[model samples]
Target: MPFLGLQRQLGIDLDSWLLRQSAAQPHGKAGACHAFEREWVECGHGLGQTRARRECQPEYEDFMECMHRTKLAARLKKILDQRDKMIKEGKYTPPDYQKSQEEPRP
Candidate 1:
């Protein structure tokens, strides 16, 4: 295979590994796949660690953003669960089912 293609594959593999290492987050994360392009810019030797780190910045940023969003999703789920529990316990009232009142005309 060509040199750049091999480099690209190496980058992709590294990103995938990083994502799997942190997969506890959630589904929408798309894990590391979301930042493969950024990974491609930064993998391998001779770039100097600092420069490589700069190149990898985009990937790092997206990974954190995905984690934050996933946490938000978890928070929403928690809130919804609490709401449901409250409604069930008569601590709060759920709005009556309104869809049933909408006439379905033949």
Candidate 2:
């Protein structure tokens, strides 16, 4: 209630503030690995600690892999290298936007 006037002036309500805070967190709602995180959480939910640890190992591993982005980084690097090679060899054609920018508008 203390900051109600300021909140009104800024047009930011409690829900939006909470959303902003969560988005600032590492694994918040906008996280890229949400599907894997959900799988891990659902796998471990409502189970004993030991059972959850054992049963959810795969899900947890998948989630961790997604979070770390190791595979994604490697794949991205490979694609970039291939693109660079193509460009160097004159095999890569510039996009239409680039071509248009190089030429004068009719």
Highest lDDT model number: 2
Among all windows of ten consecutive residues in candidate 1, which has the lowest summed lDDT?
A: 14-23
Model 2: lDDT to the true structure: 0.71
Model 2 lowest lDDT segment of ten: 15-24
lDDT of 1 by residue, 1-106 (tens): 1356785866644434453433444764554545553453446245767886777676666656564677678899999899889978999876778324776799
- Write out the backbone clash pairs for model 2: none
Tell me the tens digit of each residue's lDDT in model 2 across 33-105: 6667767766776786899999999998998787788888999999989988998999997687765465658
Q: Residue 1 lDDT in model 2?
A: 26
- Deviation from native of the Cα of residue 27 in model 2, angstroms: 14
* TM value for model 2: 0.42
What residue pairs clash in candidate 1, if any at all?
Answer: none
Candidate 1 lDDT at 24 equals 46
